[model samples]
Target: MTDFLRRKLIQAAGSAAALGPFAIGSVSAQQKGDIVIAASQPITGIFAFAGTAMNNGLNDFVLWKNANGGVAGRKLRYVSEDSGFKLDQGVAIFKKLMASEKPSFFYGDSTQWAKAVAQDAVAAGTIMTSSTSLASSMADPTGMPQHFVPGPIYGSMHEILMEYIAKTWSKSDKPKIAYVYADTEFGRDGIPAGKARAEKLGLPIVTEIVTKQAGIDVAPEVAKLRRARPDIVIFQGYILAPMPEFVRQMREAGLQSQVMGTAWGLDKPAYDALGAMGESLAGVSPYRYGHETDSTMINAMRDFGAKNRPDMKNISPFYISSWLSGMVFAEVADRCIKANKPLTLPNMKAALESMKEWDSGGIFGTLVDLSKHQAPVGRIYRYEPKTKTMEPASSWLKV
Candidate 1:
């Protein structure tokens, strides 16, 4: 890390440590004492990288908002639980948060957990959104009402990747595609979507590679993809697993296949691992690191990093995503507070459902069109290791 980046990370860590356990003033003292948002993440196990990023973003946003006088003049409180990437533990933690505090909102770590929380959130009438981009099923038009996905669903990203390849590699015959995916539901979810789109584009999936979360070796898989000579290798795995290894090995083996990643597996850890070797590894992401478009929000993020998390240089898409979540929650709560609605789960859901083309200010450009309960669209970013940066590969895609 550069000297500037190192100093920034230290600041981020200090800011994170200063954020204590969440609490609020007496409900009787104020109609809206504190806005409690419950976050359940896998901070200990396989998805530690993403979980850490999500939590750090959540805490950082809360601190940033608090420093600015908080959301709608109400302080934000959060109960973040570590689920250890276990499904059973996830359910237990969700129950604890619901039973103890009855939080106004739920923020989930991964797609599976997002689905697990959907029914209860709806039954309780609490508005919820996820950092997970894979739960298109939960965000399905016909399925859940109180749930929102702020990023591109994996299925949509896969479609975009295929189109990019088709338009970019128009002349290649037998454009072989390789698949390297984790065995978990979140990782495997991208495969069918990718395959269906690949078939439509007439591209052949020549090599299929699956690895256990416990075992993340991609050398064998990379060798297979190399042998197949695929024009592109699509990676779908945990952030902590085979992705970085795959990228490094693919480069070591002299494989020229372009690397495309599904949503969950895309982040800074992937880039930091492969370094310059990760240049050709492109993935669909919700936010671009070097975005020149929203300077105001970008600057706010920079200030936050400089003040609190200097170590977390090159902010991940999850940072913007979590920041947006906090911003949206605050805005909706503010609307309810202004309308004299009670500050409770039901009231919050009412406010969120009534939310139209809500702008997240400079935090997010996508309109929070509640008709879809999803971000208007998401952007794709490609990592350019040569510059140690990530740049937009396309405009916001609405698929």
Candidate 2:
């Protein structure tokens, strides 16, 4: 770790120690061979399908880790609550877990909840990860220092996509682009940075369309996009519903612009909803798909699913991402123990930041980097209807 990061960890540890009983009490009384990990997940509402799969994947990883002797011989005790995809509910669940469970680590549901409980996590000296990969704000070491993810943030994904677009542009004229995102923090988190990057690439953002997560009428949005006539439309902040509706509506309105999505916007659930329309879609993703059998981790996930959830047919990208999140926490915790450091909040943070080119067992295409607290690498993939898969359009690019 650099001097700057070391100082930040020391300060965080000092703050926690100074907070007296509350901070001290935040550490759960683990029995021999026990480490508690808690999460607030979106098991209902708009993100229900994706959230439930994420929960299952996380739970399965914990089970698999325990079966495999866990991290440094300490069995993980994973606990999670349903957030219902509501910010207030997520915060409430987080507080409940912090107060009652006193877990050493927490996995939050969204960018909003991560931001909401950041101070609490820091004050209590708890390490926290999130379900969302690319919330750029959470990657600020000085701001939400305890926040970390297993994949790149939204901004990095957008930057990679923009670079790809710049290279792929065949015309001498600058490519016209438009951003169509949900009107939520998750949807709009990366737009400003993305817009700045686009400007730098000489791609004019012709239109910006913000609609509700559950947009009932997308004709107007499609009409605006049609008028702009962008060469490409990048989507953010949506998992399945409005995005598919918008794409279908765009097609209906005779808009032939190539559609792309952020990580959240490009997943099995989204493709299932998009059907044939998904063929024209492409996006940046931090984790390999569940169908990528070549991955050892993915193969393990498949075996676990076959034995545990035989009724379930497919493991989505969201599930893989969630599983990777759990694995990352376990990896960091194990490293702390191997270094003879107690699995305290400060120690966990240090272990995470100390990681440099650490292999993720193929959870990600590139080695993990926790200094930025973001994955910072991914591949752009285009959906292939014939194979019914998102085939890689480019190699893993670190941003």
Candidate 3:
């Protein structure tokens, strides 16, 4: 193996050791210094909007850590690559990230690609945290400890959102519902899961529609949904794909539904693209920028935005969530260093496993219950286009 892949395998294996009592072997001086991290994201293709924000968030956290005196005298050095939201590209990047770049951990670009890379990352013994807040085959209980999803899974969020709709319009005559999604594994995962939950709640699912990534040729789908005169419509797709186009076309076609989206669908760029029509669109999201009370972290984000991305006005919830993920990783790294554990994957994973009810000072309050190797806690937020912001929709949702 190349030097970089060797380091990645060691880091992943170390994380497994942390889960148990296994001991990790030491590395030479070259791979023995600072904790190196990498992120692979969609910067040029369908997932670009969210991917760009996630990358910026990762970079910002590393800068913040370095400015704050570094994590235990070892500054975090992070890198990111654009994968274009292609599965082949994603697989290739993982091979490179593992075999050449040698990062201690990786943050996934999207849910679809997360599934593709998690297996390889696990086999290589490296830890990967995903912003793809969807439950999938990768979330199977038998999976290894290579993955961490610190947000409300798509299946769970869909159930709750459907329940909320049922309760909110309970007094009215039976309300019809419609579902629109992309034509991908990530999209297909939501259909069965949402249908099962909606049926369990006795909510009538009137129309089910799917569209491709190229553009919104969803007129036929909308016509079918309009025939049902649905009261609720849920979209499962990406910010840069057919979602905004769907909203615009559906609205222009004079078919109005109480439109909401899955976790990945809502963000500032999506809202901006849809213009005034975006007002009716809402969805479940993982983080909120203005809701933060951690003056330290919030101020840092504000300063960074002002200095670097002044034109990018609204820092969406996912952006903050991505930043928080890196912060949590840094905290784990700090713990491992304080304990004199080597800053490899195994030691860092061990430190994370040791944490319980970690108060990430302000922006994060979820308990890191690693006993089951799952992020057992999350929160839900709703967006308001009038304000162009996401507000807390519920208290922390826990498993």
Maximum-TM-score candidate? 2
**Local distance difference test values of all predictions, in order:** 0.67, 0.78, 0.65
**Cand. 3 Cα-lDDT:** 0.65
List the lowest-lDDT window of 10 residues for candidate 3.
Answer: 22-31
Write down the TM-score of every candidate.
0.78, 0.89, 0.79
The deviation in Å at residue 93 for candidate 1 is: 3.4
- lDDT (tens digit, per residue) of candidate 3 on 1-399: 335545566656655456443344432221356676787777788557667777888888888788888877877888777888777887788778666666666777766666666556655554545554456554442353455565555665676676666566774575788888777776766577668878887889998887785656777876787677787788785555576666666777787777777665766566556545545456665444443545456667877888888886766666776787787677776786577555455555567667666665445445445434344444555666666566566665544
Candidate 2 global CA lDDT score: 0.78
Clashes per candidate (backbone, < 3 Å): 9, 4, 5
The top-ranked prediction according to lDDT is: 2
- lDDT of candidate 2 at residue 195, scale 0 to 100: 87
lDDT of 1: 0.67
Worst 10 residues of 2 by lDDT: 22-31
After superposition on all CA atoms, how large is the RMSD of candidate 2? 4.0
